[model samples]
Target: MATYAIGDLQGCYAELQSLLERICFDPTQDKLWLVGDLVNRGPGSLEVLRFVRSLGDSAITVLGNHDLHLLAVAAGLAKLHRGDTLDQLLNAPDCDELLHWLRQQRLLHAEENYVLVHAGLLPSWTVEQARGLAHEVESALRSDDYAEFFAQMYGNAPIAWSSELSGYQRLRVITNACTRMRICTPQGEMEFKFKGEVSKIPAGYLPWFEVPDRASRDATIVVGHWSALGLKVTPNLIALDTGCLWGGPMTAIRLDDRRLFQVGCNTPVAKDW
Candidate 1:
């Protein structure tokens, strides 16, 4: 059985199906590692959620920023942004079930020598540390006071990781690092605004994976948030957000051989934002 790690779907169900077919995916034998952002922006979010949820054990997905936003909106803690295409999903008959399943999903998934996260980990966090921190957020997401968690979830404050951080601040740091970060200082301080290409990164900030002596650098960190960074593959990193929602192809890579498989986007979402 082979395992494939795919980029962000962002509600591109047709391309996901096309890519799976291109890879000749066999649900019974093949495993899928999805980089999250399973819904939003593009069309077919409801169908995508249902299909992926139907896969059960065949698929493993980490939660993305969009996924968390959906939960917050559903819980009445946040409002949908201007370009969000989540109305159908929010009104779906199984919306509650889907959101529950999504809340229980991991923030970071580590197996063997690879780590799967929607975004990047902080430079100071080892894979094990990251795993534990992820659980903290996961527990809050699954807790009885989950709405409280969502209520305090949005913000860019406390821009760096610290052991002294407590309560929602701590969980917020973990959540942001795992679901929204793109670039950071060598000191592990995150900058959330810049989402452009590598060369355009602001002074003193570099891609999280490029930070010197990153504690998690030894493991192959598979991430998908930076669509501008595109499809980058290296010895210890695989950055695969190919902007499928912005007219790019949906991308996937076989872990065994590192072979790439892509399917063109037929109905691209307007990049109005």
Candidate 2:
């Protein structure tokens, strides 16, 4: 059986279908690894959610920032933002079930020598440490106090990590690092504002994948949060966000051979937003 790691779907249902067809994906024998952000900002969030949900155990999806935002909005802890493309999902009768499934998904998933996360991991964490930290957020999201957790989720507090951190501060840091991080200063300071190409990182900041002497460098990391980075495949890192929701192609990579399958977008993204 083969495993395929796909970039952010971002509600691009037709592109996802076409990519699957191009790869001849076999749900019966092959597994699909999604880097999450399964919905939002594209034309078919509902369809994407429904089809992936129908896949059941055949697909392993981790949580992306957009996915968490959906959960928060559904929980009445947040509001639909200007560019959010989740109205159908917000009004769906099965919204609760969908949100539950989304919350139950882990922030990081690793098997054999491959690791899948919606975004990057801090340089400080080994794969095991990242997984453990991910579980902390997953537990809070799945707990009945999830709404309470949402209430405390908006900050960048406890901005640095240490072994001694505990409670919401710890969980928020972990969540931000996994779901929203792109660049950080060597001192582990997050630079959330920069969204340019690799060459554009500020003097003191480094891409998480480029962090010197990263503990998890031995493991292949497949992630999909930075559309600005596009579809990049290096020896140990695979970036799958190809700006699918921004008039670019939706991307997918075959795990066994690293072959790429992509579909172009017809309409431009709602760029004005």
Q: List the global CA lDDT of all models.
A: 0.95, 0.88
> 1-273, model 1: which lDDT tens digit per residue?
999999999999999999999999999999999998999998888999999999999999999999999999999999989999999999989999999999989999999999999999999999999999999999999999999999999999889999999999999999999999999999999999999999999999999999999999899999999999999999999989999999999999999999999999988888878
What residue pairs are clashing in model 2? Answer: none
> TM-score for model 2?
0.97
lDDT score, candidate 1? 0.95
161-263 per-residue lDDT for model 2 (tens digits): 8889888888989999998999887667787778889888889888989888888999999999998888889988999998877888878888899888888
Off by over 4 Å in 1: none
**Predicted structure with the largest lDDT when compared to the true one:** 1
Regions of model 2 farther than 4 Å from truth: none
Q: Model 2 misses residue 204 by how many Å?
A: 0.8
The C-alpha RMSD in Å for every predicted model, in order, reads 0.6, 1.1
